[model samples]
Target: MGKEFRNQLMKVQKQFPQIIKEVRGKGLLNAVELNSKALSPISAYDVCLKLKDRGILAKPTHDTIIRLTPPLSMSSEDLQEAPKALHALLEHDLPEMKKQKPETVSGTVPNVCDRCGRNLYG
Candidate 1:
């Protein structure tokens, strides 16, 4: 899982430089960083909301760090779908996310993930 995630996101970085800082972690527990410099200075919280709209459930760890924890029972279908969502987010949403006012974004856990319809907070 880790290798695949790294490969997929790294491919994005190569295609779209300075957007994704890194993709790394142990197993399905991983993190991704964004390059705010690539666009306008972007808040991690804003990126999180953009990712949510893409059907990814990531939370900000800091101003630029996003922690991603896929469920242990996550199926191969979800595993495949997640990266595509992330890629699309990086490709399309980063620009739109850049346009949003920083104060408008929030880090609160979403009620239900757009991907699996799972409640993000218990």
Candidate 2:
């Protein structure tokens, strides 16, 4: 898993040098940030879809960051393919995400869980 993630991360770094500011983390947990609003959740969603299409699953957190948490034992090829997929997604989707108005962007999680909309203040 570590090797796979590393390979993919390196590929992404190489492919999108202008946008990728830095990548951090280890094992199956990793994150890469872009230079601009590309880090936004809306853009991450499109990137996530691109990852999904490549058989690598990922998601965004905080609506301004994308995180990669593949199985701890994914193969090298799978890892290598992730960035390629994400690149394609970013090229097409990032612009659209940037075009959206700030008000149009939705929150990542609801204020409360569906089953417990109330706060847990006891």
Candidate 3:
């Protein structure tokens, strides 16, 4: 990962404690999560847009996670462009996240044994 991006992300983490729960990833493939399930995807999207405006394009994943996947071969100068963008998103866009209610999806994912005809749970 680029040093500049890491530096910027660290900056955001320092500034926003409640909003940014955790950050994980290697190289330029990183994710920042929100503290609550209710504030994930929307906040992530806003972060992406802020990065876009600063010419550091990124995307969101798992609804509540912001993915910072820049090219693996990014330069120091190129990497430095993420801090202000991220800060802007944290400051201005995070408060608009809607409440996330609980729901369930039906249909079990069958886990079959390689040599058995039965599903793992049954």
Candidate 4:
């Protein structure tokens, strides 16, 4: 199941080479590294917020890597949803994010828990 999830994510990386730097992990723990240069002012936290809106919860680390740690009991169908949501966001939403002014983009680091949506840094 982990391999399948990683493979699916790899396909998304292939589709958006400019945005995704790499998709790598072992077992159910994975990370998608974004090309910060390509993303410009749009940080990984921004991407996480968009992913949350799509019903996918991902955590951003190092401002460029988004971590994926799905539950062990998650079905293949549930696992597939992450990559699908990522692909859709990259395809439709990224362009608009790129067009926004840097001042308009959020610069604060993410403080919310990716799993439960609770404010962790407060």
Best by TM-score: 4
Give the winner by TM-score: 1 or 2: 1
lDDT of 3 by residue, 16-113 (tens): 87777877777677777766444544546555665677677777663467777877676776666666677776676555433332333435444674
lDDT of each: 0.71, 0.64, 0.64, 0.89
Give every collision pair in model 3: 1-27, 40-64, 41-63, 41-64
**Per-residue alpha-carbon lDDT of model 2 for 1-90, expressed as tens digits?**
665566667676787776776777777788877654445435455566656766777776533357877665666665666676777666
TM-score of each: 0.71, 0.60, 0.61, 0.82
- In model 1, which regions exceed 4 Å deviation? 102-122
Q: In model 1, what is the error at residue 62, expressed in angstroms?
A: 1.0
* Candidate 4 structure quality by residue, lDDT tens digits, 48-120: 9999999999999966999999999999889999999999999999889878745433567668864568887
Clashes of each: 0, 1, 4, 0
Cα lDDT for residue 91, candidate 4: 91
TM-score of 2: 0.60
CA lDDT for candidate 2: 0.64
Which lDDT value does model 2 have at 18?
Answer: 69
- Least accurate stretch of 10 residues (summed lDDT) in model 2? 113-122
Indicate whether candidate 1 or candidate 2 has the larger lDDT: 1
Model 3 misplaced stretches (Cα beyond 4 Å): 1-4, 37-41, 95-122
lDDT by residue for model 1 (57-90), tens: 8888656788888887877667766677777877
Global lDDT for candidate 4?
Answer: 0.89
